[model samples]
Target: MRFNVWKRLELAAVTVGIAGVVLVGCAAPDEAGVSDARVAESFAAMYTQWLTEPDLTEMDRLVLDEAQRTGRVTQGQYQDAIDRLVSCMADAGYALQLTTYPSGVIEVQPPVAVPDGDDLMSSKHFCEKTTSIYAIMGYEMQQGNPELYADPAVVAFNCLEDADLLASTATVDDVKRFMYSSERDNFPFDSEDFGVKACFYGAGMAYGTVAEAE
Candidate 1:
């Protein structure tokens, strides 16, 4: 099947896992008609692109090549990536912890004392850059979002607009930028409504794990 590879967005940290992770806010080529194949194309392209980069470890290259060949990152592949990343982090002297969410997003929890910026990168970036980064993200795109809105925040903000919950003029980026900058706590939408939750679901983002919690 043909896929319209998405234009990768500069997604800021959605969960504070790693710096500059390629998830949560990746935009598609258009608002609709995008699909899992498209998402896979974007990810697979990255896999190929990384092959051109000299620094990628041979092990990582093997994993990426497999994903590209299959046009998707399977659960086994994603798990392997997580394992590789965790092992790499251990080698770097950081004992990072893994938190698994139902939607296939893994939270790599660095220690509380871990400093931000360069120090953080020095300790953890290689592992993340090489492994599982969006083996997690791309997998979720295929599983969770079929309608494929650019990102959950974009769709949800528009949903809110329909509900009169947001200013008529506010763009998705406008709202997201504000929330990230200041309101993080005081931000307007609660995401409790079923319809709003559906908006995020349709957008490929897990609303509170993207499943009915047991």
Candidate 2:
């Protein structure tokens, strides 16, 4: 399973050349010394907390209604989307523990120059991979259970969007600090590995290490 997951991730890196548009801003200079462990812990805690909070509120309903009326999704599809969203929230805890934290599986090499755009790209790809897994599960759910909702790509994109928004709250400086630590601990996967792009791809590959373990 781990091999397969990594294979898929490598394929994604090669084929999915979509430029990462999500920008997690930089941390303030004062926060530069923060540790990677702390950043990971903070993200895990906040993500778990966010999952516990109710998400399908009045605004969500209104958005669904609008999407239905506009024919973006049928009423049935809207309900299915809601169900998938709920399930994603519920699974956040296991996903964080299994795919994110163990052994610092999500590590990235630090940028020599501050405000490296690759850092944000790494985050975007990380979130996208998580959503892709959920999307696949959604597809399987539809085939096995008629009552379940699917539209895997749509759900995945929604998940990606939501994650992007959530990541914006993290202090960028702290994230960079963590990257530096990771670089210090695990640098130059090879002499050929060069620049932020290599580091970003490495981080992207690292994203699902925990999930593959499970």
The TM-score leader among the candidates is: 1
lDDT of all predictions: 0.49, 0.29
Give the best candidate by lDDT.
1
Candidate 1 Cα outliers beyond 4 Å, as residue runs: 1-50, 115-118, 129-175, 185-188, 191-214
Error of 1 at 154 (Å): 2.9
Give Cα distance to truth, residue 115, candidate 1, Å: 6.3
Q: What are the TM-scores, per candidate, against the unseen true structure?
A: 0.52, 0.18
Measured by TM-score, how close is model 2 to the native structure? 0.18
Local accuracy of candidate 1 as per-residue lDDT tens digits, 62-99? 66677677656687766777787778878877786655
